[model samples]
Target: MRGLLKLTLTQMKLYLREPVATFFTIFFAPLMLLLFGAIYGNEPSPLFGGRGSMDVSVPSYIGLIIVTVGLIGLPIGTASAREHGVLRRFRATPLHPLAYIVSDIINYLLMTVLGVLLLFLTGKLVFNVRFEGHLLSVLGGFLLGTLAFFALGYLVAGLAPTARTAQTVGMVLAYPMMFLSGATIPWEILPKGIKAFAQYIPLTYVVRLMRGLWFGDAWSQYGTEVAALVGCLLVGGIVAAWTFRWE
Candidate 1:
């Protein structure tokens, strides 16, 4: 426990010391949210039998970015750390190495809250957008989504050999994931085949579940989304654990 704590603290310290990385990580998603919200948020909810639309899309959009940029981007950073021998040195230390990764997860969680709040507050203060869903419900979906994406990130970190490769691969993977998962484009606007295909992607389920929470959609509304999140976390975790290497 002490070892884990030290490692986690070290990880947090690294993030704290590097203000640029933290700034962009914490700021980029919400910036994207704000931009999108400014553009599309003014329009009506165009799909899913939604009511005369207002700014309801704000929270869901924030939640979606939180899962993507924050959670999915983590592995790319870890892969860079691996290439730089950060992970290798940690393995040699008395510190619990997994705890280091857990620390990254924790920091991302904190950032998620900040990002979501920023988006929500920005929309409310600037655009009069309000939410119907409980914060806890959306937060619950957000955490679940984070876990799933973190698992995917670990897999990328474990598999990608070089920092360059990690960056390239991460971009390649993240772009499609974001698009298909309904973050870049809403699933409601997508075709049937695309939505069907999205059903298999872990991030898709996460975004849907999150939207459900934000919209005050019934608990039974997104069962498949929740299931996919759990499944991805489990499978991706196993793959990452099996594939991870010090170098």
Candidate 2:
């Protein structure tokens, strides 16, 4: 446990030292909130079911964090480490390989949580964003969505032959989701054709699950979303495990 903790801390420090990672994962959502909040002013909008724009945006932005960390951060970091023989070196250590994987997971999860908190703080402090859901329910959805994405990230890391390939693939998959999944823009405002396309995107489920929970919808109301995410988690985990390599 001590070794795992140290590894997690070290991984976190390394992550923070990467300016692009820190900026996008930690600060980007909050900056988006400020920008949109300034433009929309959190006014109760008929388009957003009469909720303030910031109210809906804050929860949706949680998906943004997940996408950035899970798709962009994890795949690139893991692949780069493998490319540089970092994972190979860890194999020589006494600690199990699972220790390295777990530590990286912990590092990414912690960063995701911090990013979410910063988003909430920005919304609440600047726009007084309202949250109507049960905290536990929102938390459950958050964890489920995060794990689903993390699994996909690991799958990407395991499959890509090189760090450059992983970066290219991750961005290819992640950027479209950011726009289409309603993580960057509200689903209600999307074009009809875009909304139809977005339904096929996995991150759309995360956004729907999060936004519904944040609006105080019961868990039972989100059966489709939950099932989709669970499917993603199971399939991604199994495939990533099979394909994963130390170097």
Highest lDDT among the candidates is held by which one? 2
Model 2 backbone overlap count: 0
**Collision pairs in model 2:** none
**Whole-model Cα lDDT of every candidate shown, in order:** 0.69, 0.94
Model 1 backbone overlap count: 0
In model 1, the worst 10-residue window by lDDT is: 48-57
Cα lDDT tens digits for candidate 2, 155-229: 999999999999999999999999999998899889999998888799999999999999899999989999999
Q: Residue 86 in model 2: shift from native, Å?
A: 0.6
Candidate 2: where is the Cα deviation over 4 Å?
A: none
TM-score for all models, in order of appearance: 0.83, 0.98
lDDT of 1 by residue, 139-227 (tens): 77788887777787777777877777767776777778777877657666779988877777766677678767877877688878888
